[model samples]
Target: MSLVKKSLAKTASVVPSSTETHAPTAAIDVAQANAPVTENEQKEYPFFVAAIESDLAQLKTFTDIADKASYKSEALKRNDYLGYIKRYRLSGQNHHNTVLAWVFIWLVDLKRWDDVLELLPLMVEQKQPLPTVFNTKHWPAFVIDQLYDDANYYLSQSEQAGLFTISFVLHRLITTVKNQDWTGLEVVGGKLYAMAAKVDASLHNYGFAAAFAEQALAINEGAGVKGLLKDLQKLLKQSEPEQAVDAD
Candidate 1:
């Protein structure tokens, strides 16, 4: 087998192993052993395994071509890389998962903002939960596997539901920070920001919107988000009683 194949087999084993070691801290984490690893758990293993295997192969091909081209930028100029970029860029539904984020990052590094914007959702969705990522030091299988998968549904429900989702996710984020597991927070907070933005926008809850937007900005201020600070200001002013009356 090739180096990539061997490396992945190694990663697969190590991920499960870490989960085994950290099974005691949280009850949710304890149950992670049965949380359906995949290969998330890959939406919980045969699927995870297959998806990961396929992704690794594609990644290897991308890198090999990138290296030979030298400019790195030069490779992206080619049809093969360009095609991959276009194929992965999800249009409206904008979501990101871990696997695609890695590729999307490279595109960003190349300063392809327009391309990145189109692909942003996928890159972002890649962080969402796309292909499960387990056992990486940054994201323990336990954390990824245990995060409430129903968070989106919660956000889609009433404000109360959205609040609960935020609390639930925020608590976990704090716990990881306490434990100094910065890596565990990967894409985890995005769930919070996305949920918060939806809830606030629906209610015109400027206070919460500003807060969540701040948090997201601290992490990253992509074009869609970089405006949160100023946007919130404008939104509040626009909603003021005087401004509303002025429309008449």
Candidate 2:
């Protein structure tokens, strides 16, 4: 068997059975019904699984930057399949839908941040299991790691423009994770706050940057934000006189 198939088998064991009751949620529009799976859905499910396997195999071979960029085009082609899975979830069908889980992961991989946010609540509510290749069992941790990595990449570019986008998405992600109380791997949540601080600092939002840095330190003393928080505080102090002069 290919590595992807092996990983899929491993992931299958962790997925909750269809008979399991979903965790209650009041925020997302997904229903809480026990609707039976349609015959058409049952018939079509295997094709989606096959497609995912094919895509995963192709994804494994993409090791270069140019090859990686193709993920956006590939991901777009899967949109129709994603829609079908979304409809299944909305109908209150809670089961081990690998198609739904993989498509969500692909959206994140493609940096389709807004689309990922739209689907995040329902994914958490259903307690979806990530593909084993990611090495983390919790989706929240995976998400934070992805955002932090992206933030660092943009920071390395020394361009403030990319940081602005990361800041916007990270803020919404942090809010969604907190509001939903989606607990994940240890210290991961603090990383999100620290990245938020870094991104905001790059964008020159000193006050907001300081606040996020402080929050990161509060969450994890070893979050490495102590120096960042100190710098932001100094920046804040420096800005105060300018604000006062402007007020005059």
Over the stretch 1-248, how does candidate 1's per-residue lDDT look in tens digits? 42223444665632222123332455654454344333312322232334434544555665455453344454333223443223223122233434344444455444353454455333333445433353443322223233333444555565576555444454444333333323445355544454455456555677766676666555444414556657887877777888669887
**Clashes within 3 Å, all models in order:** 20, 0
Regions of model 1 farther than 4 Å from truth = 1-135, 139-149, 157-194, 200-204, 227-231, 239-248
How well is each residue in 1-248 modelled by candidate 2, as lDDT tens digits? 43233443554522222342573576544332445665555545565677677776777888985676586455445335554665476566777778888888877888888878888887878888887777887777777888889999999997777888899999898788875432344388678888899889888888888888887777778789899899889988888999999999
lDDT of 2 at 217: 75
**TM-scores for all candidates?**
0.31, 0.77
